[model samples]
Target: MLPWDAPLAGRLDRHPFTSELLRGNPLGDPHERPLWVYVPPGYDDSAERYPVIYVIQGYTGQVTMWANRTAFRPSFLETADAVFAAGAPACVVVYVDAWTAYGGSQFVDSPGTGRYHSYLCDEIVPWVDAHYRTIPERESRAISGKSSGGFGAMITPMLRPDLFGALATHAGDALYELCYLPEFGKAARALRTYDHDVFRWWDDFRSRPAFTKPGDESLLVAFGVAACFSARADGTPELPFDPVSGVVEPQVWERWLAWDPVRMAPGHAATLRDLRAVWIDAGTRDEWFLDLGATAFRDEVLQSGLPPDRLHFELFDAGHAAVDYRYPLALKWLAERLAR
Candidate 1:
């Protein structure tokens, strides 16, 4: 693999999208965000409309990271472009931005974060359909992402089946007990320096360079997800556990559990049954134990009455990071399955 940027057979168009839904958000994040849309090869020569796959990012992920070139591997954009160039199938890929001051919005509409879910489904989807030669029906549309983006991918279709009929999740967050609970103790130990207060840690975190201190990631995830899942009506992120004692707060923790895809799947069985395709995969040694989450979710999808043939499930021999190669595989899989 060459350590340089490669040319794409398709075209990537970048736009500045202004979200009225995000205006005056709680954290004062930008309402106008960067949006990248990729039209597959031959898009310019033909008037053919294509299926679309919307891509989101994990925690702390923004739109531009799609272009980030690591040591030797080409970015996801180059690899994704190659998927169609290799004649898998053609698609229009959209890269969405849902960043927040606390690192990520978890792609949910919350008082603490803003109407990001609405911004995606209501604003971005319509805007893309209007500006691109895309098949606007739900059967022709899909969403994909990793980690928090994976969580978004799983839930969005369940919540808004009218807009998305398929999804691909890579180590998507789920199974709260395994994926999140252990961090509570670590965060508690880290917060002792700040008098067992996460807000104090937040204040100190802002005062220094990011991740310069220990437990920054754990605390950030805790606080950021609280903002997304358990914020008070007035918009303050309420921690699900006591920072000092590391004790689970049943009510608040239950709120977080309600968003778990494993728990959510049974309720959205009818929607799952209607999906055209679903791709679920994770690393065998995922640090978050999302591999187990993937298994649980896949079982839920099957139990929901979705045809086995319509689903793709796998656990690869890898971990959470450096899974860009997996993106194109799912993209190709979804492109073939989407309404053409």
Candidate 2:
């Protein structure tokens, strides 16, 4: 295997996308963002419309990270190219950016984060279909991501079955009690130094290089997701748990639970049943215990009446980080299943 950049058999086109919904976002994040669309080999030579797989990112991830190369493995961009080059089914892959001042928008709409979910389903999907030779149907579209991206992948299809038909989630956040609750206590302890005020820690975090502090990850996820899931009417992030006692506030916590994919499955069973394919996986030892979440989500999907053959579930031997290698695996799987 080549240790460095490999030539792609496909073409990745980068475009500047301006979002009307994000123009005056609460965080004042930029309305213009990078959008990447990758066409598989032979795209130019043929007049065929291909299925599209929309790729989103985890927390703190933006569009360009798809090109980031690690030590031995190539980036997902390269590996995904290889999937089509080797003849798994051809697909047009889209990389979306939903970055926020708090690091991620969780791909949801909120007073705190703005109308990101609508920006994606309404703006980006239509923009891709209008610009590309895509099949332009839900069965022809799939979304994939890892971690927070995975969470988005799981929920997007559920929320908008008209736009997405299949999905692949790698350690996607779910089972709030298992994946998120533990962090509340750790964040509370970290808040002790900031007078139990996450905004104070946020101020400190911005004052220095990112993630330099002890509880940066936990606190960031706590605050950022609160901004996505439980923000108040005036756009203030309300912690689902008290910062000092680490006790979950019932009303706010229920708001967070409403966004949980595991909990969301029962209500969206019709959508889940309509799905053509679902790929779910996580490391057996995911640091956030998302493997448990993955398992619970799989159970929910199965119970929702999706056939066993249409679903792919696995538990790998690794952890949360460095799982980019798995992206192409799911990509190839979804490519074979998405309507041609």
Candidate 3:
């Protein structure tokens, strides 16, 4: 594919959104975020309202990355437009931005990361409903994402059943013990150069190529997630493990465990049962072992009494990166079940 913008049969409206909740965040990340809304073909010709699917990004992803063209494939926008053009179920798609100075906010509310969850549920959802020809009901809305975005998708519907009744997660982060703990060792080793201070590592990280160092990815992810999950009241990110010794700090680590989707499912059983549709899939060879997380999450949802008919779970044959092709698949699956 050419490294240029491609045409879409549907209309993709771009808007700049200023979030009151994110204003003056401790990180000083941008308050003005780019928001993209894709209206399917013939959206304006009729007075009919459409269901909405809110699309979130993975860690370190920005809104404009949705338009990025791959070597021989079309971007997701084109694929999704083809879904509508082929007379499949039609819905409005909203792409959200939740980036931070440290890479991403994990789309959660934290003293260090800002009130990103509130910004999405309270501000962005309402703003979209008011500005578009949307159905304006929880049953008509769904959320979908991959990785960190996948984690947001899994939890958002459970947290706000009044706003979203359906969701689709592609290799979402879960089963924290398996997914996160192994990285602590790598991060701890990387911290040696900075005297076991993550902030010092952060300073050095910002001054050069992001992942040039051996443990840059491990350290960056650990730091970013710590900011999202275990920030102190003063907005300082506190590592869940000792940066030098790699010892687990029980209190801080528990905070991270509490956000794990597999662990949270039991408490949110009623909400999951009330959901209209839930789609989940992960690559069998996911480097992070999120496929196991997917299985655990699906089992918990089942044990929580979510009806089998309302669910679609799968294990695909692939790895984590370059799975953008899966987005449109989940979008169509969710669209079929959403209120028409």
Candidate 4:
């Protein structure tokens, strides 16, 4: 692997985007977000249009983290550049930022987080298409991500079949009963310090170094996801489970279940059928048990009538944290099948 800060054959362009949709959001996050686009090696030398891949991030992941270099591993940007330089299919890769003060936007539109879904589909997609040499069609466009971003990839194409037609999810969140319900009890115990009120936990969280408290991560996820999935109309995050008792609030929790890809696939059968490619993978030992979620998602998509030939599914040997190497693999897979 190349050393950190090595030069790339391709060029990465960073653009600042001010979103009208996110202005004055409940969390008071900045509306001006950083947008990064990676153009393949020969992009500037040729007039050819390219397929586009939208890269979404996991919870609490911001755009700059894509450049994060681990020991003996190059960043995804470098590895992806290698793919193009070696003459695999070329594409324009877009890294989107959907961060909120709590951690992430979950890439959904809610009264609590503002219209992030609209910002991505209606604004960012059009902006990128208008400014770049893109095929500008759903068949040539895809979205990929891990965790929360993975959930976004799984649903965006279904919600807007007119915009995206392909997706790759690396242990993307799903099978809420398995992936999420387990977290409820843990979060409830953590909520004890704050009187079983997530807002109180939130206020204390912002007052000091994050994650310093043992319960910070679990509680943050509880609040952040609730903010994304079940916030009240007035913009207050409503926990799907009672924070003190860990009792499932059936109605609120159902709203969260409604977003699970496994449950959603049956309703989006027509949309899944139109997808050119779908890649689903997870570590067999994923802490969240997303490997099970992946299997369930694959089975559900197949039952929804997506051609078996169009999907790629795998359960690898590792867990969820250091799965960056898998990104380029999926990119290559998608590049070959995307309209070229």
Candidate 5:
């Protein structure tokens, strides 16, 4: 538990990681939108340099999710500040909202989502480094998040070798399991069968969620898109995977696999080699986020011949949506390495 008596309450930036809108994420599409961020407290005052943490928010979350005006900042920082202060200066924390109002940004560089991968790695990282007092190298940077955001964090550095050196994910989706054989397809149909009434789907979805929102803002977007679920009532695609066509034209599994981190990772040997630390954690009771997949990911790193210690895996006793509980540990582990 975080020591509430710790002095971090007053230690964080009076504000938080600030928001910046990076439009047209190398998508070559004008409709490409802007994503936001929250820079930590001391970013403006220091030229001495800092490591960076690209902490992503889940599908249901926005950039403001962790540093919410309500219950989180004080909750996390009370212990974290001491950890950071006692070591190197606390690194810069970045909160990148993965998507706009849609429930699915799988963090993939889709022709659909306009190459968000390039936007985050190519445009945003460099922008942050040039504008901020950063170590300006991948080894001093980290990425972390929960659920979908967790998946994003774990895979981003592997995918973007030159960008981040370390990653810490908590309760992230085992995408290898869900994307190929999603158990919740029928649930999507069951809720949508109730039809386009404004509040009906949302009420039902919350009443008995087969799958929780990937993060903060995602649920709202998912609920809003209930009328267009391209899958049928029995877990079959309304169109089919072969043609990659569906009634509503949802992004297909094949295109998704091309970008799925789990599938794409096996080939990134050079990038995987660049990792300074590769750590992932999830709750033992988190049925939605699997410990096995993350553990397998760690093993994948080892089998690739990256140092064994480069991959750290832990299973905590908890369930999903435990950010209030899991993230401080991430900060501690992250500081232990990047703060050097």
Candidate 6:
């Protein structure tokens, strides 16, 4: 497990709830993909179907990253009264661990990662709706994420309006500018040397051209996901932290392109018309270098001719701290939309 991953299993207690995982699900390969499920207290034998939200995360972040990464339960609960607090028409929140590290999984289909888009749309969602007492109707299903996840929520609803009814995003991770950079190119070439677990391969990504330093993710915060979503030749995952290998793999770059929501959104303009609701918000003070870019994406998306009522965009005075202002607003926004 990555260093950050080690802390998660223990911190599970922090939540005022019980969480479970799926092990050995060869479906979301590379890392054994698991679904972290949280059923509110009132979820006991109620025989009622609840709404569901898929919470995705940025690069390098796992499904449980938000749970372990932030102190959001209290605020998120109150803001999303339906899911968190007293269970007012309570719902289910699903966090699917997407691509991490090397740099990808805007949560779409990619040549490198097999058919993740199909997996979520075809497998994951179906599994959730089948097993859980979820409100299986598209109107009852919602999708949201932070940074890269935000991009996924934005792009997914636009592409597959039939599956998800509502969308919410915060401090989104938009990859409009990063894919063409030199480092991404280099990593694409050296994909063969990737170290699946310990990044026992390639040199640190800091040396790549025009690439943001691993820690210097000023323009964006999708690196954690970029690494996971990115794969080396032969279906191996890329390790942005690995320094001995010294470069990017080729298919890795393809995977990056595959997940880039910016490149694909323009073509889906008409699809946006079907969306019931859409929301985009980010911290103006976000350290990620792409706050301006995030705003630009929101504007461009709105300009795509989707009704003004369907698009919701906001800029707040917060930085990139998770579980604080952003989380509350995101959940509240989703609740409001799903209420419709």
Off by over 4 Å in 6: 1-32, 69-83, 86-89, 99-104, 178-260
Worst 10 residues of 5 by lDDT: 237-246
Q: Candidate 4: where are CA atoms >4 Å away?
A: none
lDDT score for candidate 1 against the true structure: 0.96
State every prediction's TM-score relative to the real structure: 0.99, 0.99, 0.98, 0.98, 0.71, 0.67
User: Which digits, one per residue and each the tens of the lDDT, describe model 3 over residues 52-71?
Assistant: 99999999999999988888
Ranking by lDDT: 1, 2, 3, 4, 6, 5
- lDDT-best of 4 and 6: 4
- Model 5 gets an lDDT of 0.57
Clashing pairs in 4: none
Predicted candidate 6 versus true structure: per-residue lDDT over 1-340, tens digit per residue:
2323221111111221111221222234454466766565556757767788887776556654443433324323233433355334456777676653344456765434455566678767887777777887778788987776677777777667788877887766565454235343344334443443233222445346535433234222323444336644454544443333434445555665555556566777776655667777777787653466467767667767768887778787777665345665566556656742
- What candidate 2 gets wrong by more than 4 Å, as runs, is 1-3
TM-score of 2: 0.99
lDDT of each structure? 0.96, 0.95, 0.93, 0.93, 0.57, 0.57
Q: For residues 180-299, could you state the per-residue lDDT of candidate 5 as single tens digits?
A: 333234333443444533245456555765355332133343332221133233322232122111133235434334545556667876787668877788777775546666666666
- Candidate with the larger TM-score of 3 and 6: 3
lDDT of 2 at 81: 95
1 against 4, candidate with superior lDDT: 1
Which segments of candidate 3 are over 4 A away from where they belong?
1-4
